[model samples]
Structures are given as structure tokens and as C-alpha cells.
Target chain A: MGEIWPLFPAAIFLSFFFLLVLIELFTISLTKTNVFPTLEPAVEILKNGEFHNALLNTLAFVAIGTPLELFAGLFAALLVYNSYWGKSFVRTIFVIPFAFPGLVIATLLFILFDSQGGFANHLFQGQYWLFPKIIDHDVAWRGSKYLALSVSMLGKVWRDMPISMLIILSGLNSIEPELIDAAKTMGAGFRVRLQRIILPLIFPAMTTVLLLRSVEMWKEFIFPYILAGNYPLLGTLIEKLYGFGSDPGEAAVVALVLVGLTILTLVVIVEITGRIKRVLVNSGVNSK
Target chain B: MSYIDRDEIGKRIVWAICVIVMIIGIIAPIYLLIKYSISDPSTMNTGGRPIPLWPNRPTFDIFLYLFRDREFWGVVSNSAIIATLTVLLTSLLSIPAGYVLARYNFPLKRFFLILLISVRLFPDISSVIPIATFFVRANLHSSFISVVLAHTLLSLPYVIFMATTAFEFVPKDIEEQARVIGANRVTIFTRILVPMVFPSLIAGAIYTFLLSWDEFIFAHFLLDTGGQIQTLTLYLNKNLSFSPPQNVLAAISVCLSVPVMVFTFVVQRYMVSGVVSGAVK
Candidate 1:
């Protein structure tokens, strides 16, 4: 009722967070070292191999991971959306991967991709359940940067795709069945129905999923930090600089980069959600 | 979920294939985790030219062995205590905060909203440094209190979002009806709105609990004391270096994930609803 119940608690937490960030920022460049760490050094720092790899690695992660997850999620949503039988049953179990902590998934996959007796390489050994020479030798998945980073992404996709499924499903519920029926009567087959009707209708929700997923991938630290070892992404780089290397200055620069990316994504989310809300209104879904 | 007819053989075929692929995807990691946990730690040479997909021999003794490790249990308890406290504290603060956010508009409301969103989305990498420094300065560094406070900051932002959405779900007419009955805001809140959104609030709490339970960054930096302060997550990561036996590691991982896995399964619908409400709105 009063401002105190919510405002006070929020103020306390926000102040703490802001205070930490401010302190790190000032100490990093403005106070201790240089005048705002001009764009030149920032660019140079970025151009360096270490940061270049991290940035490339992170972008690669977002680029490959987001669409893959969306398709997988949309596929799952399609299966569960219309199925009335045991809907809850499928959902409850299917979300098992969704329920795990990213750290735990990272750990499990880290070992699962182990070189010796690790399933990532060993699972498809001789029998070749799917294909021959699919995985013949023990590839040390976490040994190198690319394999480790990509394998870690598999874990992230598993944990997050179900969420994409849920959001898309919620959006699915908003679509009028009459439209689908009309489309069907017009000689639309399943593929056409999916491409013409379902895809366009669920596009905003899909946008929402991608936006959130992008935000998550932007801040992704645990998966890479744990599974990929010292190789840094934007997420793990800040941690490495601040925590491991003890260089708050470089850490601040990277932190600012992440902050900038996050803010941009947040603005995009606001815009997308605004679009979704307008869509919902236009379609007479929520209306209120 | 599509609306295609159930009797459509073609659609059913696609549906079954997609579901099977998804099921296989979901089961892959879990199957491996369980396989390692139950299998013998040493070599498995089954009819033997190459590695088998599963163990030649599986046993539950790894779990029994893990239960005997007092250090593991200690860290597990630390994880529980912190996560439990985080859930309670986060819910307590989030409820009223959520209520105010849903209903009221005050000075600096826009700023606060922006701040809340940023805080929720901000990577822990940046904020963790200065916060950890401040805690260190206060001499509360690496303590349970420091770790819990750090975790509260992480959970609070999103919990407030979750809470705000939950409160928004309560119809305004309901609150107005209570007002018509001569109820005060506090009475209406605790008596009416609370009950209506209690499940969502609980869902939010469980989420917060799981976050702290699974959190590593804060626990890693904050818990400087090795044996006493380490949470299960930190323990898991630390053990990664020591090269513990595979079964033991798997058992511990299973132990860490089981609570969250079970809780999500039990409250599957509520959690999904909570997510949709928060995200879509």
C-alpha cells in the first residue's frame, strides 16, 4: 500500500548493485588509471586475440544457438499445442532439462563429453545408431575452444528451449481456431498451414523468445566458464579479468560492453513486447 | 501446440517424430548423468572392442558412498540453508514490492522500472566485483550473510517482476469490492490479493531458491572460506579440479539437481503460467 513495503527493499538492493558497478567503473579508469579509457585503447583491447576470441565465441554462440533453440522449441510447441491427451504429462517430463541449473548442465555435459568413456564421442562408436563414423574416436570436447564452446551451447539449448516452447505455446493459444479452420477449408495442407498461418501468427512470440534468449546468451557465464575452461566469452571475460586476472580496469571495460549490449537488448524487448501487445489488442486477445 | 486434427495421419506422424526427437534430446544428458552415477567408476569392457553406450554393470553404491561423505553433505546443507533463506526473504520483499508495482505510480517510477529491468538483466560479472569488494571491506566477506545478501540482489529484481505480474493478474474489481466492504489496502492485500496470487508467488520463490541453490559466481567469489562456506555448486566446480571419481561426481550432480527437477515436475503448470504471465505482459 505504502511506498515503504516495495520501494525500500528495491531501493536497498538497487543501491547495492549500482554502488558496486559505479565503484568498479571509477576505479578502473577515471580515478586510478586514465581519463575515461578513450575509444582507442578500448578498440585495441578488443582487437587483441584474447578479447577477439571471446567476442567471436559469444557471437557464435548467440548466432547458432538462438535460431536452433527457437525451431526446436516451436517444434515442441506444435506437438503439445493441439494434443489434448496427457498434455500435462508430456510437459511435466519434457521440462526436466528446463528445470536444471545451467551450472549443473554444464557440469554434466562437461563430463559427458569427456575424452575417455565420455558419451559425446563414445555414444556413436561402433553400432552407429544413426550413421557410421559419426563419432569414431574420443574427441576431447572440452580440450579445445571450438568444440568445448559448441558443446557447452548444447547444454544451454536444452535448458532454455523448453521455455521458448512455453511462451510460443501461450501465443499459440491466442490465435483464433476459426482462422485455422478457414485456412484448412481453403485446401491448405499441414506444411502450408504451418508456413502461412502458424509461423506468421506466432512471429511476435517468437521474437520475444529470441530477444530473451539473446539476453540470456549475452550474460551466459556458467556454461562457458565451467565447461570451456579459461577460454572467455563476453560473459566469462569480465569474470576472468575481475576475478582471475584481478584487473578491474579491463574488467570494467568489458563490463561496460556487456552493460551496453544488455541495455540494447532490453530496449529491443520493450519494443517487441509493445508490438506483441498491439498485436494481441488487434487480434482481440487480451483487449484489456 | 497446433490445432490439426488428431486423426490426421500425416500430422500425427510429424507430431510423433518431433516429440520423439525432443524426448531424445531431453533424455540424452539425464541418461548420461544417471548412467555415470549408477555405473562402476572403473573401466567397462562389455564384449569389448569399443566403448558401450551404457555400463556393463550399474550399481547404486555410488549414492551410498556420496551419502557417507560428510564434506559433501556439509556443502549440500549450506546450499539448502542459503537457498531456503533466499526463497523466504525474496518472497517476503517481492510480495509488497510486486503489489506496489502492479497498482501504484510514484515519483521516479519510470526510473525505478528501468533500474529494475536493468538489474534483472545485468550480468553478475560486472556488479559482482564492487559488491564483493564492499562485502570484503565490511569484513563480512565470504560469510553466509554476505553470500545470501549477494544472492538476494540477484533474485530480487526478477522476483519483483514475477511478483508484479502475479499481482496484475488479480482483478481490480476484486480489490474494489474489498474496498466497498470498508477494507483497508493492507487488509485487502493480505486477505484477498495474497491468496489469489499465492501459487504464482510460491512459483517465484521456488525459482529464486533454485537460482541461489544453483548459483556459482557469487558463491565462488564470496565464500572465501574453503571447507566451511562452500555451497554445493561451488563444491561441484571445485571437485572438477581434484578429478574425483566419475560416479561420485555424477552422484553429487544428481543430488544438486534433484530438488529443482522434482519441484518443477510437481508444479509444472504453475511455473509455465508464471513464466508466460511475466514474459508476455
Candidate 2:
């Protein structure tokens, strides 16, 4: 027992709060307006149109945002992977995004994407001479649900890209340089080395990024709440229900669903990544 | 040109372009933020004239306005008070727990560690409702006490994780020597073990401070109804709802962000380890 006294405070504090949260969450979800325990809140939420919309919107957000983050991260990692002048400088720049508060980033995106003469609209509408006209009109970024959600996803991806980059960069650093040099000496080109050697080696890092980023996307609130308030994700829906709608039962239900989706994403990613890694390893051995 | 020379040149060009794009992507937004913060009314309200890339007449009037505003100071003080309390409480709870976890071998140690870390994996939004509900029922909602406790709960795991690593990094021989020298466990812990891990513990404390400072969901939920107290995050969110002038929002955002950004750059070396520790483990 090594003197159980030291760990007691933190253990009790954590467990008490966690158990309280779990019990309260379920308790609120199963009841409405001081009614006895019932499934009405969950049932009603499941049958609501807004809930469905938020669910579908959240799925789209995750589907688009997660992979976008992976690609953005992978791009940044590969950019700084090779030895180059000012490598640390470039790495610092990539990390700067993560340094900013998410609220600040969302606010900045709000300013730049504002409907009336926003920077993005000006640039895309060909007001800026350096860039060709991508659009004929100043686009109201939050004009439609899809547009609003897209902007939210863009902000989310931009803010979180650094986390993915750092994770992938650490994975890249763990690859021994000699392995790549050996491949090159054996007449393997960049493409071949990337596909065969580098990709499989960093698959776990990519998987980690995917799993973490998807969970993040599923629970994303600030960006959507700020940039796309008209449309709701599961995260923002919880806020709307609890704060404005005054429906704690329904809010708790949505919160539970968000937690469920996060766990489900975690499981699905782990299983798929595990299977894929096995296949990749077996194929690599067979090919050799 | 030789084949190698041509290939090298092509690669350099691509690398330069990519680097330029990345730099622009990161810097442009920040520049726009600063620009808006400094922009005069003429620059912001141009009557549909395309806003200049540079503000026509930049000024720090909004910054001065915020500095002079009592309400802004109140919000700033609230955020500072909450963040400081969270750091103190989280560190106090976590340091000893982390020390024990680092040094002692006990039954169910793995179980305890997972229990601590798994608490982090729960979605903050999902967890906040129940917590907020509890606070309201206890008549503690909107008080500094509830917000500090909530923020401490949010950051306790990371501090514990960081503190454990900090304590683990200290060589065991020093502790053993102290014990052999007739020093009590408390004396050795306060005198030897803690001093050795002080730097890393400070890092853990800073991390806790940042988490509490940047926290929003709990602060917003707990304090929204009371309307008596507001943190910087809630202030910004409330201002955003009323569609305040962009310059004011930018200035407030700058105030809220500068400390975090400065600390991040100053402690850039510890960042990777800290980030990886929280995420991967």
C-alpha cells in the first residue's frame, strides 16, 4: 500500500467530480421538469428536427474537418521534414496557429469573412489585383447553413492543423535517416520512398491525428457557435438547448450523444487503423 | 545545367513557394487582427469601398479605450483571479499525488492512472452541463469559487501528468541519501525532491494557468445567468453577440491572447513534450 495517503486527495477529488458529472448527466437526460425518471427527453430529442439537423451537420463537419486537418498537418510536417535553411523558423511559423486562442482565431475569421467588404470577399471578388477573380460577388460567408458550416470547418482546421503537424512531425523525426538513405542508395526515388517507407512508418501518427482530430471536430463548439450560429453542430446544440432554450434534459441528452460519438469515433478509428496496419505490414513483407 | 543541378533548382523553387504560402497563411490573419485593432473609423466604415490592405489612418484609440474602461478591468481581474486560483489549487492537489504516483509501487496504480487520464477524455461540453447543474443547485453558480473549481477540475489531470514526469526525472539516489541522512520524508520532499522538480512544476503550473485562462464553456454556462461576473472569454462572446465594432473586438482579443502567445514562445522548448504528454499518454 506504500502509504495510500498521498494519492487520496487527488483520487477522491477526481473520482467524486467525475462520478457526480456522470450521475448528474444521466439524471438530467432521463428526466424533464422535475418529472420522475423517464426516457422522454431522449425520445423527444431523437424525434426532433433540430436534433436531426445538428446531427447531420455535425457528421458533415467531422467528415470534412478531420481529413482536412490530417492533410494540412501532413503537408506542414513534410515541408519541414527535410533539412533546410531556417527549418526551425518554418517550424515555429507552423506552430504559431496553435499558439493563438481558438476564440481569437474564430474572431479573426469572422472579421476577414464578414459579408460587407470582408477581406476574403474582397480578395475572391477580384478587388485584390495580385489574385485572379475567384468570385463575381462578395460572398456572404454565413449566408447559408452550408456556407456557415464550411467557414466554421475551415477555421477549425486552420486552428488545429498545428497539433496534427506536431504529432506527425514527431513521428517523422523518429524515422532514422539511414533508412531513407539506404532506400535512395538502392535506387528508390522520392515517390517510392514516400509510399513504401515513410507512409507505413508514420501510419500510427496519422492515425493518432485522425482519431484525436475527429473527436475534436465532433465536439467543436466555439468556431461554429461564433462563425455559424445559424447552423448548429452537436456541441453548439447542447449550448443552445441549455442556455437559450432552457431545456437541460435535452441538453444533457445531446451532451451524452456527443460523448457517445467521440467514443464511437475512437473505437472505429482504432479498429480500422489496427486492421490497416496489419495489412500494411503483411503486404510490405510479402512485397519484399 | 547538369541533371542534378536542374533537379535541385526545381526542388528549391517548390520549397520556397510552399514556405511563402505557409508564412502568409499564418501571418496574414494576425496582421489583419492587428490592423483592425489599430484601424480608425474611416478605415472600418468605408461605405462599401474595398477595405485597404493597410488601414488608412491607424490609431491605438481602442486600446486606450479598453485600458480606461472599468468594466474591461473588472473582466480582466476576474479572469486573472480565476486563473491564479486554478493554478494554485490544481498544483497543490496534483504535486503530492504525482509524487506518490512517481515514487511508489502499489496495487492498482495503473488503474488509478487511467482513471485520472480518462477523466480528460470526456468531452468538456458534455461534462459541463452536469457540473453547471450541480453548481446551480448548490447555489454556487456564477461565483468565483465554482468557476475556479471547474477550471481546476479541467486542468488537474495535465498538471498531475506533468508533475509525475517532473518527479520521475529526479534520480532516486538523492531521495535515498536524504533518508539515510536522518531526514524525515516531509523534510526530504519539501527540501530535496521538490527543489529538483521545481522547474518542471513551474511549467505544469503555467500550463494550468493557460488552460484556465482560455476556458470558456464552463465559465459561460455557469456565469451566463448571474450576469454579475464575466471573464474575458465571456466578455468577448457577449460583445460578439451585439455585433460590436470590429476594432473593439480585435483589441479585446489582443489583450486576452498576448499573455498566452508570449508564454508559448518563451517556453517553446517544453511545448512539444508538454503537448505530447497530455495527448499521447
Candidate 3:
């Protein structure tokens, strides 16, 4: 007993994890919803290639959305890098969305894009009136899976872009003014200076932002759940596994898959990036 | 050349565009939410675009309704109680823990540090099931204590991270000076270290409070019995989902976010420096 006392903390931690798994199982039974209905059915779904399709959709969303957001953030940062009038206010305004809870943003978007009498409809039909034909048409943003996914992406971009912006802003701040000055003296334009100098110097920060945002987007739940409604991302799927009326076994499988995927991605990114960084540093040193 | 003047004008124009985009993307949406809160409930169902810039008839009926509702007050109290307790418990545990980690070279310190960082990185979904079940088995489910415990899990990591950074910045020479005067460890900690890091500690405390205040997942899952331990976020979610009148729901959301905004406004300076110091350093 005395000898085993040291293992108490470990035991407690394991028990806590076990308890979580148990609750997950209970919720699955309680929910009665299944991610993979049966082993055979899941196999059939895989064979039918819906699983592959879903996987592709998830990957595509991450691939496209992540880079777009990162670029948008960088662009915004660069636009606001110089100390200008109202810069602080702009920064504060941009960060407000981040501070507001995800749930609120999701709900607000829902209100704005509702098919009937929504702001989108009003805008299309009113002042601009360019899309008159489209304005008359009932566009069910929430009903269509594609539309739902798009809204989810938009919400994520809105919430997450600021994070990247903050990161890039800090990175921009760290870059030496001499480099920019030298480039300008050599008759380089703003675009030339940005492409050649700013981008390379901020690559490390960009990598960090990319990694963090990707991981965050992968695990994001509430916004996607609320916005996409029926459409399930991996996060939403895991959530459903734990939600009432979910099938525990299938949910467990999904949860395990998610954990595995996340670990795999993190490992791959870290290893690849670490190697690349080492190579770059070594090459620079050898050149010097 | 005049081309350079044109380029500067272009840059200013782009900056203006960026500011406008930000206002539309970030400010307008929040403004709409606030606007919806004051709009009459009757107008919500009419399905007009509800020009949020200025409502035709603005009223505080929704706010009045929310304030008058006992359940709303209950949720507010629950949120306050839980956030306060979480802040207190987290600060108490994390300050000393962070101090030890920062100042001392304990055995397995690196491993512990790794564990802390790993826990912070672990997605909340991975731990939610186990944490919830543990609470249930312990007969702490759906209670304020369980909620506080859950919040502590979320808040502790940040607290420790922030507090440790603060602790590290406290001059070691001061502690040595205290020791030379025959001051005990406790005295050194309370009198010397505490005062030095008081601002940072307060900043951390405020952050923890905000975290607990905003945390929804565990609170939503753990608190089953309605009105027993419903937080502001939970209450807002419940009301939002239950098809409460849009104005009322919006009002509740506004109320819910008000505290966070106020807190941010109050602690923005301290938080900015604290986060920059701890994270960017």
C-alpha cells in the first residue's frame, strides 16, 4: 500500500479519462444516434464511398479555408501595419468578434441570412438591386448542405481570422525597418518589398498561426454545430457522439478517429516544419 | 515622382477599405445583435429586414421581461457564484503552484511542465465525457461545485501560465534579501512576492473569471436540472433554442455579453501587457 501510494495521482488521472469514456458511452445510448450504424453498414458506406466523400469534404474545407483565412489576416495586418489614424480603434473592432462567444456569432448569422425577410434578401432587392432575379428566389442558406457548410466556413473565418491577424501583426512589428528602407532605396515598390522581405521574415509566425488555426478549426464545435445544423464536421460528429440520442460505440469510434487524426496531423506538421526550418537555418549558416 | 504620391493615396484608400471591411464584418454584426435586443417582439416575427441601424420603435420591454424573470436572475446569480468561486479556487491553487514551478527546481519539473502544456493543448471534447462522468459518480453533477471544478480545469492552465510568468519576473534578489533578514518562506511569498505580482495576479484573476463566465460546454452538460446551476451562457443558449421571442433572446445575449465587454474594457491594459509578456516573450 505504501509503495503504491506514489501511483495515486496517475490512477486518478486514468480514472478521470475512463469516466469521460463512460459518459460518452452513456450519452451514445441515450442519444441513439449512430455515426456508423453497424460494422457491416459502415463497411457498406465505405464501399459505397460516402465515407471517402465525407473525408474529402472535411479535408477540402480545412485546406481551402485555412489558407484563405491566413492570407486575409496577413493582408489586413499589412494594410494596418503603419501607425495610422484610428489604427487602435480598427484593431479593437476587429478583435471584438473574437471576444464574442461563437454561439452569438452563429445565431446572428442565422438571423441575417434567413431565407425570408433577411438582411441578405433586403440587400439584394433594395439599394443595389443587381441580383433582382436572385432576390425574388427563396434561397435556403441553412437548408442546403453546401450552403450550411459555407456559412460554417464564413463564421469560422470571421472568428479565427483575427487570431491570425494578431499573430501576423506581431510578426510584422518584429521585422527591421532597415530592410524596408533599404528596399525602398533600391527602387523597390510596396508590393515588391512585401513579396520579397515581409513574407519570408513572417513565415515562422505564419506557420505557428497556420498550425494553431488548423488544429482549432479541426476541433471547433459550437459554431459549426449551430450554423451547419444537420451537416456534421468531425468536431460536430464527435459532439453528436456525446450528445443525447447518439450511439456510443460509433461515437467512440469517431472520437478515437478524431484523436488519431489530430495526433497524426500534429506529428506530421511538427516533423516536416522542424526539418524544413533546420535545413533553412543550416543553409543560411553555410552560405554565411 | 507624383507616382509616389499616387501610391501613398492608394495605400490610404486601402487602409480605409480595410477599416470599412472590419466595421462591416465585426462591428455591424454586434451592433445588429444589440439592435435586435431593443426591437419590439412583434416586429421580429413580421420578418422585415429589421434595419438594425435604427429601429422604428425601440423599447426596453425585453430587458424588462428578462429582469423581471426569476429564472434569469437565478442564472445571473449562478453565473456570478460559479465565476467567483472558480476565480478564487483557481488563483489559490495556481498562484502557489505557479510560484513553485517558476522559482523552484522540483523533481520531474520538466515532465510536469510538459504535462501542463499538453493538457492545455488537448481538445476539450476529449476530456468532457470523462470529466462529466467523474462528477456524476462523485455525486457532484449539476451542482455549482461541479461547474466550478470544470471551470477550474479551463482556467487553471491559463492562470498557471500567466502567474508563473509574473512570478518569474519578480527579482530573485528581493527574495534573497528577505531571506537574509531571516524572513521565512511564507513571509517571503506573501509580503515580497505577492505585492510584486499583485497587478498580474489581478489580471489573471479577471481572466479566469471571464473564462468561467464564458465557458458553456461543461456547464451545459453538467447542469441538467433547470435553474439549479444555469449560467448566463447556458441560459442564453437555452432561451435561444427554446424559441423565446427573438428580441428577448437578443436582450438576454446582450446582457450576457455586457459583463464580458465591461470586464474587457476594465482590464484591457493589464491583460494586453500580461498576455504579451507571458505569451510573446
Candidate 4:
């Protein structure tokens, strides 16, 4: 027992890894239906197939969301890069949404878009009237799968774009003024200077933020759970399996898929961003 | 100053428009939340426009209701306790581990760093079932300690990840100087190393605090009984039934967001740099 005491921490670490592996095995082996009959029919639900779909959804979401955020963020950062009157305040306001809890952000959208008394209906019709007679006639936001997905995307963008902006802003700050001055001396215009200098130098920072944000958006649960309602994002699918009560087999299957897709996404990001030589050269030029 | 420079003005104008659109898109909903929180509940329920640009019949009733409600206070206290404890415990475990990772040449060090980063990327949902099961078996569900431990799991990796950078930034020469001055390793760490890395530590603490305070999944999954261990987010989710008074809910949301907002505002300058530094390799 005394000798075993020394091995306790290692044992705990091993157990944690064991639990993760066990979840992966269960997720891969079981039929989704047999694992979670209440959530979905066992006959049509192939664990392997659903796993693939979730992987696809995760990849698609990341692919769509990350570049979108980066472009938007970089544009905003460049716009605000040169100090202007009230720029600090503008930066502060931009960051407010990020400070609000994800659940609050989701609920705010839900309140704004939920087919009943939603602000979207009012805005679309250009009326300030509350409880407009036309709200019920509008399609429910959560009822339509595509609309639900769009709203999820919008909510996520609103919350996360500021994060990307902040990252790019710092990267912008680190670029030395002499480079800009040298470019201006060379008769390069604004677009040329940006394309030739700023873009290359900031690419590494941009890629890092992109990878982080992609991982975050892929794993996101709260916004989709609230805004998407019953639409089956990977996060929600896992939740449904767990909610069905003691369906460890199916839940494990979902978990394994989640982990595998996350690793794949990470690997892809590393590969794409691995070519840092161009960025390093640009950074060196700016430093000099 | 010349006609040729008019192009610059045009560019600035375009930039202004873009910035305004981005700000409006991000800030409008949050502004509406604040507006709704202050709007009269009666006006809200009566289907009135309720002053879109300004508060009409603004009242402190919502804030009063939140303060007076036992459930609200209970959840706030629970959130505070859990968040604070999670930050404390996460730092305790992570700082030493981070120091080791930053300074040591241990075997599997690179692998461990990769593992930590990957774990951060792994979705919380993936581990929910097994962790939940473990909690149930241990009979720790709905307990404050359980939630704190759960939050620690979510927070520890980031703390270590951030702190490693923070520790690495402290110049080795300074530590060597301290040692030459007869300061012990512990003294050098507390007196020199900690003060230098204080900003990163604070940023890490704030991040962990916010993460725990806003966490909903584990709190929802683990806490079953009312009044047992309801964090603020859990309370908000639980109260999101049909016809929850918008003003009251908004008030609660405002209350929940204020600390983070204030923290961000206070550290506004350092926060951005700190985050970018920690995250962007």
C-alpha cells in the first residue's frame, strides 16, 4: 500500500486517458439506434455514418466561419489601425458583445428573431410597433432548419469577430512604421502597401486566430442549443444522447467522432499555416 | 493637403462606414438588452414600442426584483464561490506545471504541451457523459466542490498554457541575478518572477473566472435539485420558461455581465496585447 501511494498521481492520469479511450471505443462500436433508441431509430442510424456526418458538419462550419471572421476582422482592424478621434471608444463598443455571456447573446437573438413578437419582423417591415399582427404570419426562426443555422452563424459571428479584430489589431501594432514609410516613399498606394506589406506580416497572427476560433466555433454548444433549437449540430447531438439517460454507448460514439474531427481540423490548420517563411520575412523587413 | 490627397479622404470615409457597420452589428443587440432591462415591464408586456432610443418609464423595479429574490442571490453567490475557487485551484495546479513546462527539459514535454493545447480544443460535450457518470458514482453531483472541480478541468489547461508564456517572458538573467544575491528559489519566484508575470497571471485569472461564471453545460448536467448548486448561468437557463419577465431576465443578464465588462474595461489595454501574446505563439 505504501509503495502504491507513490504511483497514485500516475494512476489518476492513466485513468483519465483510459476514460477518453473507452469513450472512443464505445462511440465507434455501437449502432447509434441501439445506443440511443429514444433519440433516433436504431435501424436507420449507423454509428459510423452519423459520425461521418457530424465530422462533415464540424469541418464545414469551421471552413465557413474561420475565414469569414478573419476577413471581417482584418478589414476592421486596418480601418481602425491609424488612430482617429473616438477610436478607443469604438474599440470598446466593439468588444462589448464579447464580454456578454454566450447564453445571453443567444437569448437576445432568440428574443429578436423568434417568430412571435420578434424584432426581426418589425425591422423587416420597418415598423416599431410591438406585437405586430404580422409576426405570427412569419415563419418561425427555429422551425426552419436553414434559418436556424443562419441565425447560429450570425450569433457566433457577432460574438467572435471582435476577438479576431483584437488579435489582428495587435498584429497591426507590431508592424514598424518604417515599413509603411518606406512603402509610401516608393510611391506605393494604400492598396499596394496593404497587400504588399501588412497582409504578409500579419498572416501568421491571422492564421493562429483562425485556428483558435475555428476550434471554438466547432465545439460551441450554447448558441446552437438556444438558437438552433432542435437542429442537430454535433454539440446538440451529444446533448440529446446524454439526455436520453444512460446511453453511454451512443454518447460514446458521438464523443469519438467529435474528438477525431477536432484532431483532423487541428492537423489541417497546422498544415495550412505551416508555411510561415513569407510572414517571417515580412516581419523581418518591418523590424529593420 | 492637395487635390491628389482627396483619395485619402475617400478611403477614410469608406473606412468610417465599415467601422460603423461592424460596431452597429456587434453592439445593437447588447444595447437593446440594456434598453430592455431599463424599460418598464408593464410597457414591455403591454406591447408598446417602449422607447427604442431611450428608456420610457424607466424603473428600478427589475433591479429591485433581482436583489430581493432569494433564488437570484443564491445563484449569484454560487457563481461567485465557484468562479473564485476555480480560479484559485486552477492557478495552484497550473502555475507550477507551467513553470516546469517552460523551464524543464523533461521527456515528453513537447507532447504534453501539444496535449494541453489539443485538450483545450476538444469540445466539452465529448467528455460530458463520462465525467457526469463519474460525478454520479462519487455522489458529488450538485455539490459546490464538484462544480469547482469541473470548472478547474475546463480552466487548468488555459491557465497553464498562458502562464507558461508568462513565465518564459521573465528574463533568465534576472532570476540568475536574484540567485546570486542569495535569494532562495521560492523567494525569487514570489518577489521577482511573480511580479514580472503579474499581468499575464491576472489575465489568466480573469479568463478562468469568466469561463466558470458563464459555464452552463456542466452546471446544467450536474446540478439537479433547486437551491443545491445553481450557478448564475444555470439559474438563467432554468428560469427561461415561457413568459419569463423580459425586464427581470435582462436585469439578471446585466448583473451577470457587469463584472466581466468592468474587468475588460479596466484591463482594456493589456487585455488585447496579453491575449494576442498568449495565443499567437
- State each model's TM-score restricted to chain B: 0.85, 0.94, 0.91, 0.88
Q: For model 2, how does the per-residue alpha-carbon lDDT over B149-188 read when each residue is reduced to its tens digit?
A: 9998999988898889888777777778778889999999
Q: In candidate 4, what are the lDDT values of residues B221-250, reduced to their tens digit?
A: 778534367888877776665548677667
Best TM-score among the predictions, by candidate number: 2
Off by over 4 Å in 1: A1-6, A29-44, A82-85, A128-131, A264-288, B1-7, B42-54, B168-196, B224-228, B269-281
DockQ by candidate, in order = 0.46, 0.71, 0.34, 0.35
Sort candidate 3 into its docking category.
acceptable
lDDT of 3 by residue, B1-281 (tens): 59879989888887787678767767767887888888874555555543445666899988897799999899899999999999988887787777876777755667666656655565666566556656777988888888887788777767877888888877687778789999997798898788778878888898888888878777877885443667888877776567655677678778878887888777776654433233221
Let me know the TM-score candidate 1 reaches against the reference structure: 0.85
Structural similarity of chain A in candidate 3, as TM-score: 0.77
Better of 1 and 3 by TM-score: 3
Estimate every model's Cα lDDT from 0 to 1: 0.77, 0.88, 0.71, 0.72
Of 1 and 4, the candidate ahead on DockQ is: 1
Question: Which ranges in model 4 have alpha carbons more than 4 Å from their true place?
Answer: A1-60, A128-139, A269-288, B46-51, B171-183, B224-227, B268-281
**Candidate 2 Cα deviation (angstroms), residue A141:** 1.1
Model 1 Cα shift for residue B176 (angstroms): 6.9
The root-mean-square deviation over C-alpha atoms between each candidate and the true structure, in angstroms, is 5.6, 3.2, 5.1, 5.9
Query: Candidates 1 and 3: which is better by DockQ?
Result: 1
- Candidate 1 local lDDT, A1-288, one digit each (tens): 355455677667776677666766546633234556455436556666888788888878877887888887887788888674678767766767777878778888877777666655656564436745676566777788888888878888888888999999989989999999999899897789887688778888888888888778888888888788767898788777666677656776777778787678668767977786577567655543
Residues A1-288 of candidate 4: C-alpha lDDT, one tens digit per residue? 332232234224434644554564454335453543343433224544654565565566677877888887787777678645678777777767788888888777777775755557656544654434543345678888678877887888878878898999999999999999999998998889887788887877798788778778778788878877566678777777667544556665666667777778778888867756555676678988
Runs in model 3 lying further than 4 Å from the true structure: A1-57, A126-134, A271-288, B41-52, B225-228, B272-281
Indicate the residue-level lDDT of B222 in model 3. 83
Better of 1 and 2 by DockQ: 2
